[model samples]
Target chain A: MKRYFWLASYPKSGNTWLRLFLESLSHEGATPDINAMAFSGGHAAVRDEFERLLDIESNDLTDEEITRARPRMYELEAQAANAPLLRKVHDAWELTPAGEPLFPIELTLGAIYLVRDPRDVAVSLAHHMRQSLDQAIERMSNPQAMMSMSKRFIPKQLPQRLTSWSGHVESWLEAPVGRLLLKYEDMLSDPEAHFGAAVRFLGIDADRDKIAAAVEAVAFERLRSEEKARGFVETPPGVEGFFRRGIAGGWRESLTPAQVTRIETDHAAVMRSLNYL
Target chain B: MQGDLTLCGWRVRSALALPDLLPWLGGDSPVDIDISFGAIPTPAEPPLYTLPHSTLWADGRFLLHLEQVGKFWVEKGRRIVLEPAEHADESELRTFLLGSVLGVLCHQRGLLPIHASAVRINGRAILIAGNSGVGKSTLAAALGARGHALVADDITAFDTPTAMLLPAFPMRKLSLDVLDRLALPHQGLIANRPGQPKFHVPAADGFAPAPLPPSAIYILHTDRLLKSCAIDRAAPAMAMALLDRMIYRRAVGMKIQPPPALFLGLSKLARIAPVYRLRRAEDPSLHRLDALAEQVEAHAAVTRPLLAGSGTE
Candidate 1:
């Protein structure tokens, strides 16, 4: 009985465009392989996926001993899952440092979070971190803004604290008690009714021609012509693409009214409760 | 049980206490391996549980478990037991029993170990295969700061009927961001766990303790859009499929497989040494590893391996 969700976001919120519509839901006429998004399940800040789920290498631990060994490495990555995995967390709903609950909400079976518009996620997090739009709106209003904290090397993920874009969407929309939230401008104006209510909030029961063919099999002009014909190994090495401009209010044509008033006066009360004041 | 200690090139006899390693002083000693921490359990259960941190059942005896660290049972690979977990700590259960229970007991004694890192330049063995932060112990600590030796870390293993390249512990777990990006000096290192910024560095002098064979193998790939530094050479059918996917915990390397004469001795070690790839430029720039150790000491002085074509053909 392996099931775990969390696609949770805040780094250019739309979390890989809602993880390419949950990796094209349950494909029918096959358009899936947007570079093998075959049921995505990859990052939740990877430090070599908790040193491959505990064969252990955590580059000598401490980030609070790797968040107290991440709730038993997400409960043995949800009992070594056979089917439902999802993953992709951009860190924020944090806790462990001798506190607890750094995602072991009893082996979660829910979470999709997704949020956006911290002024179009500080212009797609300053072009997926190449940086600038006033340093990505001063690191989305830094509250100790982290992400691969790099002390020079050893950073293949697992440092992403990102506590500020309104405490990363109120820490995964106020954690615990199953979540689904979704709103990268409502999956860019109805990705078949917000990814078909996140595939019936993970119960999955579709309609409307298989949720409009898993929303035209993850369209954003076919993930920018498949990352302009294969280059995007999660891009961002002097970035040119990670599917940019998947349009949400172009931060009023590229923010600069002092970076859109420092992302609307430092995310004015979570952008006026997500209405983007 | 706090007695005998040799590491990665095992003779290990333990009950725990694997401090910064370094004890097994060479002499091709007859196999010993033994390690014990107490009553183990997990020697069966394995119906494809797909890795949540540990689980290997393998037919004739493998049983790896490893959840909160401990449950090892390496029966046919010459024995290892470890049970741990009751406040488990001896440098984090000997760092997951020296990586995937010493690379599944060096693939149950036939040894083809791989997930590499090696050095010994002049007397051969260059190696260095990748994929776990692809810097193979910061290029084997910049080829042991250019005096070259270091020979093996994170599982190199080979030595069966002298396919050579064995030697393993001289210390190099790294990651205090590769000792401040190779400016080195961590002063008698050793923090590989206890609030880990990963230390275990040690090697004030080249440490190749013996076993040689390899003459060139490369395969690294840091590439943040690789804009300089390339290295190439691989095709011999991609160096026999990157030595059948760089073995070490090669996901239960097919339950310690290595027979069929170890795939005809790794395709006669890909026609006796030569498998390049290399990449670079995920730039944290320590003079771009002084141009990747001057292109790996000019490709280990032009692909060594010719002490009269070191027999494989």
Candidate 2:
């Protein structure tokens, strides 16, 4: 049985960038299309694939029912995969209503969790969700913050329960699946060391030269320029673009001091553990 | 109450009240399918396809185990055996029976079921196809509100021999936001299932009971960057591929060895009828719905004369 790994992170943490780097590694000598990346095609929250795999309509099922079905859904996906699969996930590590881990542990090879500073996340998340800075901060601190949980209309993707940023990091850290933690700030500071470590964790036999080539292939400047020339399909409807200022600590310039304090106070414990504080 | 019903041109004898289907008016015609309350038999061998609550056997049998609902066995496209759970909502039980089970039956009978919501405009059926929750129902409802009669919602089964699109249930499964968006009252509307915001809105005003020959197929494509609606006619090759993707329960349908007639029917349908890519903004505003309906109507009108002259049917 071919197991899968999750490129797991809260929204606006460098999940997409890391995924692009992996895509670049596989498709050497060419720039990977930002829209058609492997992980992008297989998001954990995509509703269509779930419905197809289970032979059931998701709209007919309640949120609780959908949650209960999710673990087995991934198991089926694992069985169907010809090679090791990688899925992008925004949902926090949690249990289904049946008390089973949502991403079946036996079918999971590991999770590459990308942790970004909550303060920075709030700044980037505001732009991504089209929310004000204050609203974004509140969502980051909200224990029940959920994406696509709207009962009014069915969003394209399934409901992703992203608890507060602190809770999100802790959940994945303590999950039963094998964990390879890579901080977003560290990746930006030293791409060679951090990204190379990630490739090795995935059991890929790549030297530093290949890893550096993949990293250089997806530099933030190239990605931003690419999004400018040809619009990115993943960009939200009203958002200007997805690759907005792919730099760390933008909160210093973009966020109000009070806003920073809010994220800090809410997530200080987790931040201190990760040496963020 | 026993349900002696007709669904998509089949005589159905059901134990549950499948109110969505019309009464079986073909008095003496032998029942084509049976839906009974009974024990669901387990498959003798390992399932060909297995999910959390459902499994499909190699012999073309399907079993669905809905938590707190019931266990369902759909076998040979002729019989459906259901064992209702304690206090299971009848409407909930009927919902899956009509949807997933019926879709499997369509495949078994060698019919082409497209994942679409279709409406009859200018005396012919126009299928609006897309993935789930792409506003297929909402768009069909909008067209229906514009005096077009609804042919089907969700699953539009195409009968290959007659080259006609058999209408499914005369009901639109709409979410609360859609009801609010269309200003439809949900006061007496029954939710498809308990705890789900979707309601089963009966299409009594102008429900097309008889199968209508399909005239055009519109595949809904929403792009965030797109500012307005753009309808483009797809080439023959692309149309065939896109229409294949629109097959209802396509994954499950693949488990069944489809007859050669299914492909031949699809090819003929694609060759004659126009398949259009109806591109619209991902976040279409209120007025966009009306504009979309107008564009579709105008396009259908323009193509009618051309189709009449071709004599391809």
Which pairs of residues have clashing backbones in candidate 1? A53-B53, A60-B196
What lDDT tens digits, residue by residue, belong to model 1 across residues B84-173? 766656777777677777787777777777888888888877888876777787877877877887877767887646667778777778
> Model-by-model lDDT, in order?
0.73, 0.84
**Each prediction's TM-score versus the true structure:** 0.34, 0.92
lDDT per residue, candidate 1, A1-277, as tens digits?
Answer: 5767778887877777666666676665246666567667477767766765555556645565577778778787777778777788888887877687788777788998888778777777778877777888888788888888765456677776877889888887888749989887877787788888888888876677877887887788887887787665677566788887788888888776877876788888988997878
Please give, for residues B116-200, the per-residue lDDT of candidate 2 as tens digits: 9889988888889998888899889888888888898999998776778887878899888778777889998888788677889
How do the residues A187-213 of candidate 2 rate in per-residue lDDT, one tens digit apiece?
999998998988988887777778888
**Best by the lDDT measure:** 2
Candidate 2 segments exceeding 4 Å error: A38-41, A205-210, B42-49, B57-59, B257-261, B284-287, B304-313
- The residue-level lDDT of candidate 2 at A237 comes to 78
Residue B98 shift from truth in candidate 2, angstroms: 2.2
Model 1: DockQ vs. true structure: 0.10
